[model samples]
Target: MAEISREYMEQVAQMWNARGKGLITHMALEIENVSSEGVRVRMPFNPDFCVDKDQTLLHGGILTALLDSVFGLANFVTIKGISSMATLDLRVDYLRAARSRADVIVNAHCFRKTRHIAFNAGNIWFDGHEDAEIARGTASFALTRGDTSLLEAMTKGKAS
Candidate 1:
């Protein structure tokens, strides 16, 4: 793969984070950085969050959303732009619970992607820069030949 410019990658990542273009808002899901290599995203514990009642700890489902979003974004970056790739499967194993008292970080990346499957890995961190490795897994995404609901969703999400 050709080297991608950092500026360009950031632009695309920002575009992906747009409220209209994505379900994961940048403010809600802080995608602090993104490159051809990986993406670093942060999500703070909000008592208002619909998932869990604990104000300090993040919900596993929220972590899963973070995982899914980062993985999908990373894979989209690997394509150098948007494509018809759709997540066929995603499996995550949660090791330790996130630190109850602080914000959490999700660092994710795609190793390589083929015509169909995209391999990815990442970890969750709490109250530190080092990955806590709270979870890690691979995703199988199939590249669609033409317009599918994924693309339509992307389009609609962006249009708003």
Candidate 2:
């Protein structure tokens, strides 16, 4: 494989929470560090992110999405600095309820990859420590090989 470029990574990382330019953006999810096998993502706490029935705690589904996306991103990072993979199996374990005031940092690593499958692992912590593991996850995905390219994937069959 060729060497991965910083431009490639920054462009791809921006895509992590970009649904489009104006409609939705997770600009709050900042990438602190990146390597070929792993990445670290940080999200600032906001009172608007409550999860319990009373909306006082962090929600499980949001945690799942954050962990899953980071793990899946590790898989894509192994590729040609582009993404053509989606999760097929995602299993998450909630170790403890997290605080809405707790800032989250998700660490995910690309452990292994086969010809068609990628394996990844992730840990979510509110305070970025082993003792703060509010959740942990393991996931698998099937990589899709293609020639159409991401540009087409982004603009095809959509209004200009």
Per-residue lDDT for 1-160 in model 2, tens only? 6778766666666664563343124526777777785888887775556755666688787788787778766665556623367788989999987864767889998788776788889988876465768999999888766675443455463322
Best by lDDT: 2
Task: List TM-scores for all candidates, in order.
Answer: 0.78, 0.78
TM-score, cand. 2 vs. native: 0.78
Worst lDDT 10-window in candidate 2: 18-27
For each of the candidates, the C-alpha root-mean-square deviation to the true structure, in angstroms, is 3.7, 3.6
lDDT scores for all predictions? 0.68, 0.71
Predicted structure 1: lDDT: 0.68
Mark the regions of model 2 whose C-alpha exceeds 4 Å error after superposition. 18-27, 53-55, 81-83, 128-130, 151-160
